[model samples]
Target: MTSTTDIKAIIRRHRTRDAAFAVLGMVCLLVCIATLMALLVDLAIDGVGRLSPGFLTSFPSRFPGKAGILSAWVGTILVMLVTALAAVPLGVAAGIYLEEYARKNWLTTIIEINIANLAGVPSIVYGLMALGLFVYQFHLGQSILTAGLTLALLILPIVIIATRESIRAIPGSIREAAYALGATKWQAIKHHVLPYSTGGILTGVIIGLSRAIGESAPLITIGALTFIAFLPPAPVQRTFPFVNFDWLASPFTVMPIQLFNWVSRPQQAFHLNAAAAGLVLMAMTLAMNGIAIYVRYHSRKRIKW
Candidate 1:
């Protein structure tokens, strides 16, 4: 029923809306890219001077000539490894149980809701909890062990959620087939289900660990000392009285904490050091994420079945 002029008007208006939407999207995308580029440029310009062999190897120092992040780097790696160890098994297991074992009951629903809520809770809150339990009540103090455990707790929900999602994405027919083959629940999971979900689980773990490694609020709250020049020594017995868990009582520092300290200082050199440390941390995180992506790509491409 429309005339030629009416049809033209409708078409013109539609084109205008499309154009506006496209422009808006492009503007948003460009803004994000520009922000990333600006930050990288700033970091490189400021931090390149501080990236030296000495910077990588020497322990932390109050004096610029002697300053380095060796201990902080070492402790950070150790804590991250320990955290991964604690988080992966439990997170993956919890995920697998939720996806494969748990029934759709009110109890499971409540647990799931709690986990989601926990993931959203502030990281510092977990640190405070660790402070109360491990530092005050049990007297574990603000040591590497307590810090690692606190981070573990902080990231556990994330890991569990990621793992559950990954496992759930697997087709149910696979499980049904395994069951039809007279496989028990554990056998089906161990032999068939797990192999299928390994890559997904690894990806989730890497992501969780990435988040944990950069976290400073919780670690700081747990009293990770800013200046601990000496490497954490291996536990030794002092047979004067009751046994003490020395690992849980020692002071520690980490990359993010050191970066925070350096950035807050008045000196420009400290600011430079903070940027260099930021670059290193970013590189480490990107490497972990890359590895996860590679695993996912290869695993998906090389399916045996």
Candidate 2:
């Protein structure tokens, strides 16, 4: 039989180790929170004053005091439009096919492995590929469409993985019940799978877009201009069609590139502009994440399962 002192010693050692780990985890969490708070505070101090209406409406100018993000933000919106339009349908469709329809085989296995690998591929590699495929071979030029397509490619794997995972989370019993009710496979997926997974899919899509928005490396490699004062042609026309597509082929710059331009300038005032632009970017990212969280929460609440 074990002595009472030995049992007490073992218990004391385990408790000591557990407390040490708890303290270590808390320290790491505090360090991360402190660093992020410090950066945000610094940005607010330097840039909050510059976020005025005029700053939003005006275009980039040589004079830092007069410069704004009109073109940058507009370009960002339009490019995001293209990215979503290109990525969502394709990614979702591919995911559905792989997860629901495709037979277990070598080909499917290879495709899955490749997609998982692609998700981790560096962004600059995508830029170079887009430069050759879209710009040279397709003659698309360094335009908004090219930029959008490049980012779409970069995030396609992310969307596909999210789609598959979300769909997989639904119980197989649900699908079987639909089938037992004489529902077609398509009907079951459409009526049940899609609705249940919409929240997760949207979260992934927005998260991917958020990452794409802040990326400057791929855009730069694809020849995005660093300085732009002119807006692309308006996407609405006053004529019979009442819609315009010229903006797709036009030159553009995003907020990150614009901020980079300002930061590169010698003047101290431009640094302030850079800080302001950084603030706006951070706000936009946060807003996207907030929307994702809100949607996910509501969606999960509605799911009885």
Candidate 3:
């Protein structure tokens, strides 16, 4: 319907405008990738020299000359694992209950709003909650348990949000099919919906864990001890027995916490150690993210629709 000259003019306009838009988008993406690459390169350059077995095996030292981060490394792992065990299941369960069982009423709406708000609340607030409840009221002291609980509280909203999203992403027809087949809500969710959503849920859990591991403020505010000569043996061997883990009651430090401590010290040795520790922290985090990406990739491949 258009003349050849008109069509060519339209095409020429689109060619210029579309080219500009594409170039803008590509430039933004390239900037982000370049920034990340720079960060990793800097970490490697600063830390590669100090990476060693002795660095990983030594305990907290009175002098920067003699210190290693073994105790802090172990403590970080213990705290993270315990928090994951507690928060992931509870958060996911709460999310499922809200999404599947709760009524569409004002009270439920309020609860959802509150949960969403809590997600945005600063980690320092969780720290205050831990200090008030675990230290002063419950007498758990400034132990690993206290820190884990604080971290759990800080990350619970994230876990719940992720879980709810994963569950919601499951097709409603699947649930309806189970219902039409004489299956109860529990049976449908248990045998079919949950299984289908498990991969997504796990992906969310791992991402939440990744965020939780890098948190330093909440732990510090909740009284994560900066120095501990001995690694916590377990949950029961700790001073606080009521919390189900003894490690919760003792003084402890994590890799991030130790790195922060080292960085604040005014010495070249501490600086080098901090860089090395930062390298370790980044490596662990990158490895976790890599695994999450791989899992998510494989998981998506298995989905039928």
Candidate 4:
């Protein structure tokens, strides 16, 4: 019903709106990148000189310049090991069961909904829950085991969600082909499904672990000390068939906790230490993500379907 002039005007208006939106989006992106660059530059300038062997090797000290992150780094690694071991297999298995075996039932729906909801829950909430169940109810005390288990729980939902998405991305025809070759359901899933989805699964693991690594609230909530001065006892005491897990019960402090403690202090040197610790944590996270990306690239290249 519009006249030619009115139609042209409307077109011009639409074009203007679209251009405005495009500019806005670009501006937002640029702002984010600029802020990130500024932060990284500041961190580097503040912390680069502090990233010395002495800082890496020594235990944390009351004196800022003498402080090191050995105990913190070791505890972080140990806790991550426990978290990965506990979460990966169980989460992946649960994802497989939900995707491959679960029917379209109310229970399945409820579980899926709950998992999605849990993913959005605050990390601090997980900390409180861990504090109650693992710390108090289980009487695990403020130890590496309790902290690791809490993180495991915190990241489990992420793993399961990632696994499920990875599995779903595989074409159904692949499963049908495996079945037609006289493979059982379990065999089909084990061989065809898992092989194809390993890339996404690994990516998910890396992401979840990265999230766990940065987390402080849950660890703090579970009573992880911020200024741990000593390393946990070694897992192996004797050389003859040596293996012991007593160290799992030892008190722990991770990089994030250490960094938090440093940042909270009144000393300028402590702030610099925090920055260095931040760099280390950032490096670890980036390394994990890089490995995941490489794995995904190779996996996709090999998997044509």
Candidate 5:
């Protein structure tokens, strides 16, 4: 009877501890959400008045009232385009080679460890590296291409890690089934592995791009101008072939640099401009994440297992 009473006491204690932990987790989550909400509210309050069509279309000016993100946003888009073009394919290919084709060995193990470590390296390190390798050694100039490639290098590890993790999540049975059907390794991977992993891969890509979009350190190190009044040459042309690549070699500045420039000014109006730019940057990030969510949902729905 005494032993039974002791067991009951232990059960009650365990339940109480579990309840306490649950409450603690809830409080932490609420704290995070509340903090984020407060920041969004503050940004909105300070910047909403600046969000007009004219603000979107005008160029940066010495006067606060005339300054806009036209060049900044355009440069950002062009830089991101180059970044995506350079990083996505190479990162995905490297990931597939490592995860699917590489033999299990010490070298592979070392490579994996280094890749993971690279993902955690500081953004400034990449900036410094690019400054030497791209600007000095390769003579890529302080152009859009240099900035894009620099950001691509920054995010390559992230894409590779994400791709490997996504590919690893697929069940072995799927690959086995494909092999059992007399499919070659490449065919099986192309048909079974890739389709299932597309959502996760895209999520990683978007996440990398999101990070790339906000990065100013690498671009600045590579000589991104803080003040620019002109846009890059148009990527589209009226002539034959109808597409142009001259913009890739043009000078540029991104939104983060523009915001940094504004925030550094002594005028109160520029501070408001900075806040508005921050809101736009946040919106762009959220939009990219939203697309990732939508794609992931559909991809998961389409694939049962």
Candidate 6:
């Protein structure tokens, strides 16, 4: 009878503790939501009125009223295009080689450790490295190409890590089954592994690109221009048979650089402009993350394994 009473007391204590933890978790989630809500509200109230067509189409000016995100946004798109092109293939390939092909050797272990360590390095360090390699050695000269390469280096570890984790999550049985079917290693990876892992790969890609979009430190470290009023020339010329690569070498400014310019200014108007730009940047990041979530959800749903 005493033991039964003790068991009941223990159950009561556990239930009480669980209930307290549940409430605490809810409180923490609510606080986070509340904070996000407050920020969005502040941004909307301060900047929503400024999101006009003219604001999207005009260039930066000495006067805040005339300043727009035209050059900034355009430069951002061009640089990101370069980064995605350069990083995605290399990152995915490296991940595949490490997870699928590499043996349990010391060199493989060293490479894995180095990649993990690289992921933690500051973005500014990548910028300095780019400043030496791309800017000085390669003589890319603070162009869009240089910035893209720098951002690519900054996010490569992230992509590789994400891809490796995604690939590792697949069951070993799947690989064995592929081998039993007389499939070569390359065929197995191409047909079975890649199809199943595409969702995860894309999720990683979007996440990396999102990070690339918001990075200011690396770009600034490589001497990205802060004040720019003119647009880079079009990638295509108006003349006959005209496809141009010249814009890749042109001077550029990204949105974050422009935002920094605004926030650093003494004028009240530029501060408002900064708020608007912040909203735009936040929207771009959220859009990419949303896409990643959707891809991951569908991928998990389709592949029960």
Worst 10 residues of 5 by lDDT: 296-305
Off by over 4 Å in 6: 1-28, 238-242
TM-scores for every candidate against the unseen true structure: 0.90, 0.93, 0.86, 0.93, 0.90, 0.89
Error of 5 at 221 (Å): 1.6
> Candidate 3, clashing residue pairs?
144-248, 145-248, 235-245, 235-246, 236-246, 238-246
Per residue, candidate 5 scores C-alpha lDDT tens digits across 1-305 of 56988999999999999999999999999999999999999889988889888888999999898889999999999999999999999999999999899999999999999998988899988999999999999998899999999999999998999899999999989999999999999999999999899999999999899989999988888888998999998999999989999998899999999999999999999998999999999999899888888877887788777
- Regarding lDDT, does 3 or 6 come out ahead? 6
**Candidate 6 residue-wise lDDT, 47-69, digit = tens:** 88778889889999988888899
Q: Which pairs clash (backbone N, Cα, C closer than 3 Å) in model 5? A: none
After TM-score superposition, the amount by which residue 192's alpha carbon in candidate 5 deviates from its true location, in angstroms, is: 2.5
RMSD of each: 3.6, 2.2, 4.1, 2.1, 3.0, 3.1
What TM-score should be assigned to candidate 3?
A: 0.86
Per-residue C-alpha lDDT of model 2 across residues 82-189, encoded as one tens digit per residue? 999999999999989998999999999999999989988999999999999999999999999999999999999989998998899899999999999999999999
lDDT of 2: 0.93
Worst 10 residues of 1 by lDDT: 240-249
lDDT of 3: 0.84
Steric overlap count per candidate: 0, 0, 6, 0, 0, 0
- Model 3: residues with Cα > 4 Å off, grouped in runs: 1-31, 234-244
Query: Which candidate, 5 or 6, has the higher TM-score?
Result: 5
Worst 10 residues of 4 by lDDT: 235-244
